[model samples]
Target chain A: MAEVKLTNVVKRYGSVEVVHGIDLEIAHNEFVVLVGPSGCGKSTTLRMIAGLEEISDGEIKIGETVVNNLPPRKRNISMVFQNYALYPHMTVSENLGFSLKIAGKSGAEISAAVANAAEILGLGDLLERTPAELSGGQRQRVAMGRAIVRHPDVFLFDEPLSNLDAKLRTQMRVEIKKLHQKIKTTIVYVTHDQVEAMTLADRIVIMKDGHIVQVGTPLDVFERPVDTFVAAFIGSPPMNLINGHIEADHVVFSDGNRLPVPPDFTGKLADGRQVVFGFRADVLMPKGHTLAESGVVTDLDLKIDFAEPLGSESILLSTLGGKEIQARMHNPRPVNEGEVLTCELHLEKCHIFDASSTKNLRE
Target chain B: MSKFSRAIRDHAVPLALIAPSILVILVVVLLPLMFSFYTSFTNYRLIRPDTLWDWIGLRNYQRLLADWDFWVAFGRTILFLTVALNLELLFGLGLALLVNKITWGQRTLRTIMMFPMMFSPILVGFQFKYVFNDTIGLVNNALQSLGLTEFAIPFLVDRWLAFFSISFAEIWMSTSIFAILILAGLFAMPKDPIEAARVDGCSNWQVFRHITLPFLMPFIFIAMTIRSLDVARAYDVVDVMTGGGPAQRTELLWTLIARTAYDDARMGRANAMAYASILLSIFFTWYFFRKLMDARKHLGAF
Candidate 1:
């Protein structure tokens, strides 16, 4: 296992720059996921690390050696593509043994390695079957088997499970995590799915338009997002961001709605300052149902447009200060549409961002 | 009408629509085929209408068994087909590979490469025949001007040179068929497996040998099948250039068959020869088709 470091990595397509100079360091054996929206350059960064895309600027180091100029094979990296990229002409046994054969290993050694990989992947019966005969999940397993057989220093995955169905994606995600745990190899995975990032990454690197926005542990980024983008991107259903301004000791919305300045940010803020109030649906629940017990419980009558009961909890769609917002309810009750329900906003669990520039005020 | 009769009438409408085509095939194809088979058993001659009633049975078949000239022509045609096909495949593959690597001007180059294939075989034959003429040919004139030779080379008169000249013209006209089909295969190939191969530590040559070549095999066999059938009717080129002349040096089956049928008026013998050559064509097509199936199975295409 080896650490991967990218110093001022930039990728340019002709005169148009796609990935700006971005620096990152992935620790050895760490599962670091580069998560972002489409065209956010996360895949480009991963490709640069894999040596599939050329590094236009700066240095990339695997362990101690600079690998900026190295070809993919010479970089000693194995990548699983989004499509699983299995060779259609070869059987499972041949696919697994390709790398070893290319490395000039003996026939016995290649067969043994292939057998071991097939065993780990539970592909004993599929050794002779070509990729076309295998199901999508089996092809994915063969792709992974091919990667692991090479024993590369770093494993790169470019949205490897995005093609699978939801259930299969989840199952494969768990298997990939388990594989990482078993092998203890440094892995850099790129995906646009935040759920996959949150569940699989040791640390999530949030990117936007070729720039790294935030790099933190899953819980850290979830509990404390760097800005409105991260706050909305991380959690399912997203965090509610209501625009407002600071006035004396209270935060005021455009529609004359008011709430006390979250006690944590009172000292650092100034009067007449514009800010956006952000909070997750789970944190702001029906009155007396909030999980945060020690926070200032600001209760308000919210008009419920509709409610979605998800068995354990219900997501109530409502509006606040002339903007649409969602509130979570734990104890399901028959609340009719257009009913004004009292909901509490946990001040301790809220995020306040500067309205003019969307940076978190609490950061 | 009853329900059964109505259903049958509906099916008849569709069948009636295609009846004209079936009639045309019977008159144009099946009738001639049956008549030719019957004529092959008789001692028929184009100039003598009375010979149509002369049923000679196995006499013409017996003569064919001892016909050394016919066998030599058959063997020579096979040799020509083999040499031309293999050379075309090699050149076509090389051209396709080189063109596939081009990024800019690719469309223009592709259009230009199809120019040779557009020319008729007769035109190609005439073009090469003049270029290889004994005294007024481009090749001999250029060679003499360059001090590479003293006397004019009788290209069409010499046995081996005539064969080479005809084969060269045929290859020039048809090699692009292989190039175009193989290029299409190259286009349809997915980029993922190639990248995966590279990531699996395969060098450029190894990736091509193990991955690209196998992927292109099915396309190659398809091209071979088509060109084999097209080349079996290699009458136009050979007839135009040498007319199977110079002591029957480059006498293909069709050339000899045409001479016997039209010039010598031996219609029965020509029909027998035509039937025999049809078997060779069928054999090559069946062989290539089998190879194509094997290649597809190897690729797991089902």
Candidate 2:
């Protein structure tokens, strides 16, 4: 295993720069995933690391050696493509042993390597079968087997599970995680699916518009998002944002109602300044009469528009001060559409951002 | 009408549209084939049209059983077919590989390569005939001027040289057919497997041999089958260049058959020879098709 480092790596196609200067360091034996939306240059960065694409600028180093000028074969990196790319002409054994034979290994040694990989992948009985004879999952296993036989320095996976059916993708996800754990090799995987990145990555690099937005542990980026973009991108049924203006010691809503800011946030704000308030859906709850009657509760009256029952939890879609809001609650209460309800916000979990720049207000 | 009758009525329009084509085939192709087979069983001669009605069963077949000239042309035709087909495949594959490597000016080069194929086979025959002429020809004149030969070389008179010349002309005219088909196959190959092989630490040659060549086998066999049939019945080039020549040394089946039926007025013997030559074409086509199917099966297709 070897640590991989991309120092100011850049990729350009003609005059268009797709991947702006990217610097990333992947630890030895770490599974780091580059997660982003489509056209976000995550796959381009992975291709550059694999030597399939040239490094237009800066340097890439594997361990202590610079590999910017090395070919993919010379770099000793194995890549598993999205389509499984199994050789259609050869039997399973031949496909697995092709690289070994090309490396000038002895026939006996090549056979032994292929046999070991086949046994590990549960493909021992399929040595004589061509790729066309195999099912999709079986073909995926052969693609992995082809990579495993080489025992390369690093493994590059370019959305490898994207082509499989949903159920097969889940099973293969676990299989790939287990394979990485068993091999203990440095893996740089690229995928547009956030759930896959969240489950498989030791550290996730979230990208947007060819720039790395945030690079941290999955929970780190989720709980302490760097900006509004990350706040909206990381979670399903994403974090909600409501517009308001800071007025003295309170933030006033659009309908002329006011809620007191927590004491910690009192003196830090400027009056008459516009800001956006953010909170996760799960942190908002139905405001009880005791809190409401105390006259000190920070709550908003909302008109419930719809409710989506998700078995154990339900999502309540409501409108507050002419802005849409969603709240997740575990207790399934029978709430009618257009019914008015008051929900209390948990101040500790709420975030505030500048309305103009969309930058987080947290210190 | 019942459902079956309605279905037949629904298909009647298409069948009516195709009826004229079926009638044309029956009259133009099937009738002549039946007439030739009938004539092969009779003592029919082209000079006497009345002999078409006279039937002497197996007389022409008996004569063909003892004819050495017909068998020699048959053997020579087979030899020519095999050699020309193999050479065209090799040259075509080589040209495809070289052209496939070129990224710039590819369209221009492809157009240029097709110039030879655009020329008619008869025209290519005349071109090569004049080039290899013994006297007042460029080849001998150049050789004599360079002191390679003191006397003019008789290219058409020598048996081996004449055969080689004709074969060369045939190959030159048709090698592009193989190249174009193989080039199309190469262009359609997926890039993923080649990349995977490269990442798996395969050399360029290894990737081509283990992956590229096998994928191209089906295309190569298809080109071989087509060119085999064309070369087996090669007539225009050989007819124009040698006309079965001074002593019938360069004679092939079609040339001999043409002479027997049209010149020597023996339609019965010519039809028998024609029937025998059909076997050669059928064998090559069947063998190549079997190989093509096998290659596709290996590639995981039905």
Candidate 3:
């Protein structure tokens, strides 16, 4: 296990810089996931950490060694690629033992290591089969087995479960979590899937446009997103952001309707200050289905445009202050399309952002 | 209706569609093949038309079994095919690897890589004939000027030198076929496994040997299959450069066959030799094709 440190790391392709100067530190055995949208430099950062891509500036340290100049092999890191990247020509045993064989281990030693990895991955029966003969889940297990045999200081996963089906992804996610628990290696996994990041990461690093926007626990980032970008990108259905301007104790909408500022930020703001109100679907439940009974509750009747039933809960798509927003309905029942239901807005969970800069006023 | 008639009627449209192709194959391929097989058993002479009908039976075959010169040519052809094909594969693989690394102006470099293959085999023969000429040739001149040799080398005249000179031209003409096909394999390769290997503590050479080369085996075998057939029945270059030689040192099957058939007008004997050469070519093609299939299966591509 190793703690990884990235100091002002930047990546550039010719004159075009993709990953801007970014700094991050991952603790020993910490499963830190770098989550962002596509082209957001999450994978680039992971590749830099893995020594697959050279950083343009600054340093990367793994444990006590500065690994900026080290090749991936010299750095003692193993990466599980998104595609599984299993050597199709080799049998499962050979694939698992490849690193040991490459390191010039004796035949007996190689076989032992191979057997151990196969046993760990429950691939004992599939050892003689090539990657082509295995199912998608089996191939993924082999990819992890390949990584496990190395027993490197850090394990790098580049969207490892993205290629699997949803059901497999979940099963593999649990297995990966279990693997982390067993091995306790520092893992730097990159993915655009927020669910993966939220579930897998010890600390989630939310990045945008090559910069780390927020780095905190999954709940920390989710409950308190650093900005509107994080607020939307971190949660499914995303946080709804409605624009308005502050006016004497109330925020006035474009339609001239007014809403009292959530008590925490009340009177601390100047009048006529433009702000964007943000709230997640969970925080804006219909009155009878309020998520938090203790939070400052503000009621508003919202005309439901559509209802998406998702087992026990349904996401109600509605218009608020002429802005389309999503709200969660607990113990959901079929309601008329145009029904105006009063939704309880948990003021403690609602966020207000400065419109011009889009930064959370709380920050 | 009869079963045969009903079968024909049932597949009438398909048979009618393929009729022209079948007719073309009968006229172009099958007829000539049958005629050659028939001539191999006869004392058929192109110069004396009456001898074309003479039934020599196994006389041509019996004479061929005893012909030391014909056997020598056959052995030399096999040697030439093995040496040329192997050397081409090695050089072609090296060239493809080096070219695959060239990231800038790769299209232009790939185009330049195919220059030798673009030349007709006849032209390559003539070009190398002049280049390796004992006097007033590029090789001798370059060697003399570079002070590597003091005298004319007699490249296309000496026994082994003549063999080398002919093989060189054939290899130069066709090595790019292997290079182009292997390069295609390199392009189609998923880069992930190579990266995974690198991270798996493998050196660059280890990655290539254990990963890249195995992946490229199918392409190499495919190229080998094609070039094996080409070199096994090699004629044009050997014919132009050595003409089966000063001492028959560089004599391949076709050159000896052509000389026997045309210069000596021994059509029956030449036909017998030609059949042997055709069988040799088929054997090489079949062998390499089998290897290719095995290699593909190893890669799980089948």
Clashing pairs in 1: none
A185-301: candidate 2 lDDT, tens digit per residue:
999999998889989999999999888988999998877777788888888788887789999867787977676665457689999989887778866766642222232336777
DockQ in order: 0.64, 0.64, 0.68
- Candidate 2 chain B: worst 10 consecutive residues by lDDT? B293-302
Candidate 1 residues A157-267, lDDT tens each? Answer: 999999899999999999999899888999999999999999999999999999999999999999999899999999988999999888887888888888877878877
| List of chain A TM-scores, every candidate | 0.98, 0.91, 0.97
The lDDT per prediction is 0.90, 0.87, 0.90
lDDT of 2 by residue, B66-117 (tens): 8999899989999898889889888998999999999999999999989899
What's the distance in Å from true for residue A68, model 1? 2.1
Clash pairs, candidate 3, are none
Interface RMSD of 3: 1.7
Chain B TM-score of predicted candidate 3 relative to the true chain B:
0.95
lDDT (tens digit, per residue) of candidate 3 on B1-302: 69999999999999999999999999999999998899999998889988989998999989888999988999998999888989999999999999999899999999998999888888899999999998889999999999999999999999999988988898888889999999999999999999999899988999999999999999999888888878877888888888888878888888899998999998887899898778888888889888888778857642
The top-ranked prediction according to DockQ is: 3
Sorted into a CAPRI-style docking class, model 3 comes out as medium
- The model with the greater lDDT, 2 or 3, is 3
**Model 2 clash pairs?**
none
